[model samples]
Target: MSRRQRAASLAQGLLVGMTLGYTAYRAVTLAVNARRFPRLDRPHAPLRQRPRVSLLTPARDEAHNVPKLLQGLLSQGADEVILLDDNSSDGTGDLARDLCRGVPGARVISGAPLPDGWSGKNWACQQLSQAASGEVLIFVDADVEWHAGALDAVLAELERSGADLLSCWPRQDVGSAGERLITPYIDLYLLTLLPYPAMRLPLVATATAVGQVMVFRRSSYDAVGGHQLVQGDVLEDVLFAKRLKARGYRVLGALGGERIGVRMYQDYASSVNGYAKSWLPVHGNSRLLLSVALAGQFCVYTLPWMLDFPGARLLRVTGLLERSAVAWTAGRRRPADLAEGLLGPIGPLLQLPVYHKAIRRKVKWKGRVYEQ
Candidate 1:
């Protein structure tokens, strides 16, 4: 064969090897972990002595969402529910007070002014923490809705696992085509990349958390300095989990599945704007690492489909199957969502511009600039 033919053969062989290896690894690990990982979506026997549970939610212009959350919390059997109104231009505080009126153990607190060197969400959560009187503190976002018996299930799991901090991954409720196309990547990375079992090991610092729903023991939160330690971080959830693990506090993750759900963004524009704010921070704000990660995902998921080399079809099919399995396991696999996942690298490819925008500090969220 000519030198050109030899190079082509080498490249084809390498692609085939990578495709096969990744497919096998993904399929087996996902299958094994599916059974091993703890799920909070199921029912559990009631706790003998319910810990004094305090539910905290921070709202910023969440007038439309607060009512649903308040209604849900009323049924969760929490000892108290504290809502922090974070200087929303809209009448979120008034709406909350009106809805919570005459409701026992539920109150809305006006959030203090944002202090320098602190993110809005973090500062709000810290204020809520200070006023919380529960033994178990559950921090939830305004957009999250809890199913019946969700709080009991979480408390049961926390007791059984003996974890100081527990973060539950809510079932994502995607509305628009943009949401379906983009959001599965979050679960994809969590399921495939994170070594879930190793997170408990002191040697491995592979800490991660979903911010939508997190339960922390008040003692542990106080010991770890709570949100105050990560006050300036945009990705406070992940950083707080890491800090807890570093301090020898046991931290665990659970799949909320149907027990808890969140509508992350309404439409394409909102999705783009929301993700742009944290894409760079998620990758630790390192431009080099972001480039490598994006390039690597593109090569693995999209390059084979573009090539006309031998075994290209097999490579593409394997890639699609692996991604489909990931989506299915993550509870995000609908026909449309899976079809978008099959299109390969479109999601990560679309994120390139968002990453650049984030790097340039041009991303704004909730009327605030997150300039570095």
Candidate 2:
């Protein structure tokens, strides 16, 4: 090879090495932290007696999932479960109404008409928050099914920790091949940015919350202007978390692991399109950064395989060590006999092109079309 080409290759190799090293370092830390801290599932007394909670769900054409979700909420020892129907044509509204009539302390309200420039889900949530009469407001999605103790456990965690907001990273159930490829990357990116270890410490101002399950103190929500603060944001959950931090509110986040679970997407197309819809917006509408991020994502996921080719597998060895180190440090429990490191090798490839298209196309979510 020519000297110039060799220099370029070496530079790429070094970049890959650095990325892998960082990944391993993060993984090891995450795993060790998991072992160090006791689990957060044990029972605790609610901070106050009979603390009223309004569990709000925003739904648009989520008829299929709403029933199960409502059943799960009813089983929870909460004060109320409120459903905000965002004008669904698919009988989601009717189903919600039925559940409301059947269950005590359950109510369904018609969401106000969508105003221009506002995301539908955010608008619906804002209306629900306004109507709710609870000391604590919990926003749980229609697709989420919680365990019996989820409500009690989460409330106890928030009250004990004195956090204004608490969000759980629910266990993701990926049934399709597409999900297997895409869902893991979601957690990977989350960990890369918001390390589990850092979450337990006060040094970092950074955090993230799954929209599937989020609980907020009524005061904290109003202080940050609630959903109004993130009206037009597609990634409202992240933006809401940011507002909480900005207002000097401590936000607590944890791995729900088996504690919570959600089936986010039904198929590959929806899964890919779902990410393309908000991944760019999450970075603040910067296409330039989006392009660069896509490139970096692919390189970090794929480079080790390329460099390890026609060789003594040093590059591949480095990649595996890096992956294992990250997996361990993330503190997520995995079977000792299983091999999950290879999944990351191709995970980004599945997501990068989808994001590229998402940046170019309009996203249709919750019966609204958003142009990129």
TM-score of each: 0.91, 0.86
Q: In candidate 1, what residue range of length 10 has the lowest lDDT sum? A: 339-348
Model 1 lDDT tens row, 1-372: 999999988987886787667756666677765766677776676788889999999999999898788888878979999999999999999999998899889999999989899999999999999999999999999999888888988999899879898998887777787666666566776777665676667742677888888899999999877899798888888888888788788888888776787888776667666777777778888878777777766767777767766666766776777667776676766786566656565555666666666667556778877765
TM-score for predicted model 2 compared with the true structure: 0.86
Cα displacement (angstroms), candidate 2, residue 171, comes to: 0.8
Model 2 error, position 237 (Å): 0.7
**Candidate 2 ranges beyond 4 A from true positions:** 1-13, 36-50, 200-205, 309-341
| 310 Cα displacement, candidate 2 (Å) | 12
**Which candidate leads in TM-score?**
1
Evaluate residue 268 in candidate 2 and report its C-alpha lDDT on the 0 to 100 scale: 75
lDDT by residue (65-176, candidate 2, tens digit) is: 9978888888886888899888899999888788779677898999888999888989989999999998999998888878767777777777777778788766565566
On lDDT, the leading prediction is 1
Q: What Cα-based lDDT does every candidate model obtain?
A: 0.80, 0.72
